[model samples]
Target chain A: MQVHELRLPLRAEDIRKLKEGDKVLLSGIIYTARDQAHKKLIELIEKGVDLPFKLRETAIFYCGPSPKAEGKVCGAIGPTTSSRMDGLTLPLLQQGLKVIIGKGERSAECERQIREHGAVYLTAIGGISAVLARTIVSCETYLWEELGAEAVYRMELDRLPCYVGIVGD
Target chain B: MRYLKAEDIQKALTQAICQISYESDPKAVERMRTAHEQSNHELERDVLGAILENNELAAIDNIPLCQDTGCTVIIAEMGRELVIEGATLQEIADRAAAEAQGKCPLRASISYDPLFRRKNSGNNSPAIVHIRQVEGKRLKLKIAQKGGGAENMSFLMMLSPATPLEKIKEQIVQRIVESGSRACPPLVVGIGIGGNFERCALLAKEALFEELGRKHPDEHYAALEQEILSMINKCGKGAQGMGGGLTALAVHVLHEACHIASLPIAVNLQCHAHRHVDIEL
Candidate 1:
C-alpha cells in the first residue's frame, strides 16, 4: 500500500487521485457526525436553513469522540459503521461532501451515490479509538448539545490515518 | 454459612469494569499479535499494528481504548453455599457499574428503553447481569464491555434438526463471511450449537469467556471449531476486512443437548477491541 499525506477539505481533483487500498494521512478540518446528527443536519438542509457547517468540498467523519477529560482536547474517537447513515449520506455528497470517513462498507445505494457525486469513502480501523484520537489537534462541539456524543463536533486533525474504501470514477 | 459483603463484590466488579475498559485480556492481545504477524496484506498489517499500539497508548494515557466503551455485560456464577449480605447482586452490580462508568466516564451506551424514548441513560448503568448457581463457594464474574458493532452482526438460527451438520456449518460460515468489515474482523467468535432459543444465545456468549482460542474438549466439537476457524479465515476478510490470510483470531464453540425437534445455534462475535475480564470474589 502506498502512503499519501493529504490535506483535507478534499476537492474534486484531489479525491479523484485516491484509490482503494491507499493509505492516507489527512490533516486539516473535519466535522464529526453520527446517527442523530445526520438526521438533524438533513432536516435543516431540507428546510433551507443554515447548517452548522458548510457541506461543500469538505469531509465528515462518522464518529463521536469520548468525553474529554479536564485537560484533554478530546477522548478516544473512532470511525463508526458507515452503512447506518446510508439514507442520510447522498444529500450531503450532493451538496459537495467530497469525503466520507468511517469504518466498514457502505450500502449499494450509498456507494452508487458516492461515485455519482464524485465523493471518496475512507475507513479508519474501528475500535482503535485512542490511537486515532491522538491525531486530533483540537475539538469543539459545533451543534446539537442535546444529542451529547451524537452532536456534531468540529475537529482539526493532524495526520489522521485511514484507508480508502471507495473512490469515484 | 460463609457471608461475603456486597461491598466486596462491588469493589471487585468495579475493578473488573475498569480493567476491561482500559486493557484487553492478555490472551486477546497475544492472538492479535499473531494475526498481525500472519496477515499478508500490508493494509491489514498496518491496521493491526496501530491496534496493538493503541493498546499500549490507552494504558499510558488513561483514555478508553474505544469510544464505544460498550454496554456492560456481567455474568455472575454464584456458589449455592455462599451467602450474601447487604444488597442483591443486581443492585450491587448496578452501583458498582455506575461508579466505574463515572470514573472511566465510559460512554453511556445504554438507553432508557430500546424503543420510543431512545435516550441515553447517562452513566451506562443497569448492567445486563446474568446469574446462575454453581458448585463452588467462590463467586466468578465474567465481564465484557461489548460494543454494539460486532454484536449487531451476531446471529441466531434455528436450523431443522434433520438438517445435515455440513449444511448448518455452511450457513454459519456464509453469514459470518457476509458480515465483512462490519463485525470487525479479525474477531473472536463465540458459537453455541445447541439448546433452547435463549439458552443457545447465552451459551454462545458464555463461550466468549472461554480462553480466547481454546478448543472444545469433545473431539467432535473441537474438530468443528477448527473447521469453522479455517473456513472463516480462508474467506480473506483479514484484519478489518482489508483482505488477507486471517479473519478471526479464534472460534470457540459450546454445545448442549437440545429438544429432539430443535437445533438452535447462536453466534456471538467480539471485535478485536474486546474489553473483557474475569474476576473471582
Candidate 2:
C-alpha cells in the first residue's frame, strides 16, 4: 500500500532507478503507436531504413489515440495491449528505444531484452481514456496518418499520471 | 411485431455506439463499485476508483470511453415470427455502424484486409452481428463496444474430455491472473465451455454481454461462477495488477453441449468499464 511520487520526461536510467509499484506523473513528449505502427517500424527495420526519431532515453507509449477535438490537446488517450509489440522490442531497443509504457506483461523474450537494455514497462489504467487524455497538452499526427487511429502521433503531455508495472521480473 | 425500419436500426446502432463508449453498464458499474470497496491493495483500489470515475466523466462529457472504440459487436435476438419489411438485418447493422462512426465521430478502427492492404474500413462498419430467434413478439438489440486490450487477452483451450473441472478452473484463473493489468483488471471473466473450439470461443465472447455479477439460473453453474470469481479474486491480481483484493468483479459462464471426446473452453476477459446496452423493440 506504500506509494511514491515521481516525475518525467524520464530517462532509461531514471526508470532503472525505480522498482515495481512506483507511481509517477510523466510529462513531455510521448509518441503513440499501435499494431500497425509496430509492424511498419519492424518492416522498416527489415528494409534497413532509418527511423524518424531517436529511441534512446525516450518513452514509447503503446497507444492509438482518437483524433484530437477542435482546439483540444488530445482525445481519449489510453494504453493499448503491450504484448502485441513483443516481437519488435529487441529491434526497437537495439535502436535505443529505452522506456516502454503499455499495459500487460512482457513476453519472456521481451523481458530478457528489457533487462539487457535497462528499460522499464509501465501499465496505465485501461479504459480510463478520458482521464488519461486530460494530461496531454497538444497532439499532432507524425507519421502513418493514413492508418487512422493507428497513426503515429507526437503528443506533448503535462504531468501525465502513469505507474511502473513490470521491471524485468 | 413491430417492423423496424433501416433508419431506426441505424439510429439505434449509432446512439448505442456513442452511449457505450464512455458509459459503463450499470450492472458492471455496480459490481466494480462493490469490488473496489472490498479490495485490499491501495494501488489496485486506486486503479478501480479511477475507472469508476472515468465512467462518470465519459458519460457526462459524451466522450469515447477508450481510444480503442473497439470493433462493434451487435447481438440481435429476433422473434421467431417477426419479419422486417425493408433491408436485411445484417445490412442495416453494417450501415448503422458506418453511419455512427462518421456522425459520432468515432474512430475508424476496422481494417479492410487483415493481412493484405490493411486499409481502414473508415467508418467502423460491418459489425460482428450475431442473430438468434426466440419465442417473442419483440426484437432485441444488444450492442457492446469491445476494447482490444481485453479482446487480445481472450484465450481458448481445447481440453481433452478427461480434463477435470479443476484443471479448467485452473487454466481460466491462471490466464486471468497472469493477464493482470494487461486486460484492464477488475475484469469481467466470461467463460464458454463444452462447445466445439469455435463455438466455445463465440460463446465466451457472447457471454461478455450478459448482465455483470448475475449467475446462470441453473444452480450448478451459478455455484461454478461464484467459485471461479472467488478463485480469481484470491490471486490478488487486483484492479490493475497492482495487487488488491478483487481481481475480477464477475465471472460469467456460458456453455453448450459438445462432442463426447472434447471439452473446449474459451475465456473472454472484459475490462472494468464494460460498456454495453440492450433494447427490446
**DockQ of every model listed?**
0.78, 0.64
Instruction: Give a tens-digit lDDT track for model 1, residues B77-151.
Output: 999998889999989988887888787767767777788887877778788899999997888889999998899
> What stretches of model 2 exceed 4 Å from their correct place?
A1-13, A42-50, A166-169
Q: Would you list the C-alpha lDDT of every candidate in the order shown?
A: 0.87, 0.79
Complex DockQ, candidate 2: 0.64
- The model with the greatest lDDT is 1
Model 1, span A1-169: residue lDDT tens:
8787989777667888888999999999899999889898888889988775777745899997778876877877888888999999987886778888999989898899999888889999988877887898998998887777788989998999999999998
Per-residue alpha-carbon lDDT of candidate 2 for residues B108-175, written as tens digits (9 for 90 to 100): 88888888787888888778888889896678888888877788789998899887889878888888
**How high is each candidate's TM-score?**
0.98, 0.92
TM-scores of the candidates, chain A only: 0.96, 0.89
- Relative to the true structure, candidate 1 has a C-alpha RMSD (angstroms) of 1.2
Residue range with the least summed lDDT across 10 consecutive positions in model 1 chain B: B103-112
The root-mean-square deviation over C-alpha atoms between each candidate and the true structure, in angstroms, is: 1.2, 2.5
Scored by TM against the true chain B, the candidates give 0.97, 0.94
